[model samples]
Target: MSQNGAGVDLETSLGYLLKEASSALRAAMEEVLRPLGMSVTHYSCLELLAQRPGLSNSELARGAFVTRQSMNVLLQALERDGYVTRPAKAPVGKALPTRLTPSGRRSLGAATAAVRSVEVRMLAGMTETEQAGAFRILRSMIRSLNDGDGNA
Candidate 1:
């Protein structure tokens, strides 16, 4: 924000706004997850794996919006923690699919519930239709950003 007309400056770009929102939401999530002995990244990955079991490393990376190297490291750590297990489907280098162990599935269920609880609390004042509208607006923003044409 600045002394300008709209009170938004370069620092208030849409990317910055989204990042700030993410930070706030993540803070709330971390508060809820701390008692469960899980970090936000761990919880997110577990949830994603639960939704798409046996997703390949590359697919998981893209879905997680991270690099393959980072995904591999996270997978290794989760495997060590018995949260996820990777059975060798083929040669490791090309495309190795990973599956969630039973423990991983359980963790995902718990984390998903916890996240939804937090989200509901955060959206308490909003009606269902308002919630839907907010989500739709966010999705449209993301689509427009990714499209880069701004035609819509």
Candidate 2:
């Protein structure tokens, strides 16, 4: 309990701290991404496409942590803007596999550099070993939460 017996001792609560850290990380990413006319979700989508090559709308939505409808809207804009491409019709089921165009890959390269700077700044104070340990701990926490919710 806190000194005053509050509902939760946020100063020592890992979950509270984790949420705070996530917020800070997001703000920092947004600050960097704003000048490029990209949101975190936008960059995440491009980055996912860069790595995965041909991911479906729903798969990209899940990976980017956005709703399928939202992803579809973004995909439409991306396709119109010449950043991504989809077949005239679905190659297999109802899902159209999405891929990045050359322009999209070029855009992703710039975003990747900007995002990497934020990550480097965030990890500046941590030693390699400490960073590795933190990675393991954070992954464990994610697994625990996801598993508990049957989403893992």
Candidate 3:
């Protein structure tokens, strides 16, 4: 309960703090990516493709935390810009596997560097041990929430 016993106290809430941190991180990433003509989602898609080529639109959407429709639109733009390509027809199913073109790989290199700088800046104050501990804690939190059984 809050100090007034009414609801959550934003001043002392970990959830609120986490959200603020996420917002700050996103803002920092946007600032860096804007000059490269990329949004976080755009960068995410390219990174996903680089790591796991031949991912379907749905898979890319899930990985990037965007809707399938939004991913499709982004894919269309990427295809038109020669950053990615999809076959004229699905070889196995309705899902057309997408792959990054050479151009996409080149663009991803710059975005990766810019994103890395933001991450490096974000972690400047934390020690290696602290960073590792934070990573474990965050992973545990995600697992607990995903489990949905109050078994953290």
lDDT of every model, 2 decimals:
0.82, 0.94, 0.95
| Candidate 2 lDDT trough over 10 residues, lowest sum | 1-10
Q: What lDDT tens digits, residue by residue, belong to model 3 across residues 1-152? A: 35584668788878899999999999999999999999999999999999999999999999998999999999999999999999999999799999999999999999999999999999999999999999999999888778987555
- Estimate the TM-score of every prediction: 0.82, 0.93, 0.92
Off by over 4 Å in 3: 1-3, 149-152
Give a tens-digit lDDT track for model 1, residues 1-152. Answer: 36675755657688778889789899999998998888887787887888888787778888878888888888889989898877755555668777898888887787788999988788989998999998999999888778967554
Number of the predicted model whose TM-score against the real structure is largest: 2
CA RMSD of all predictions? 3.5, 1.9, 2.7
Q: Determine the C-alpha RMSD for candidate 2 after optimal superposition of all C-alphas.
A: 1.9
lDDT of 2 by residue, 28-131 (tens): 99999999999999999999999998899999999999999999999999999999999989989998999999999999898899999999999999999999
Tell me the deviation in Å of residue 19 in model 2.
Answer: 1.0
Question: Given candidate 2, what's the lDDT at residue 23?
Answer: 99
Model 1 misplacement above 4 A: 5-16, 89-93, 149-152
Give every collision pair in model 3. none
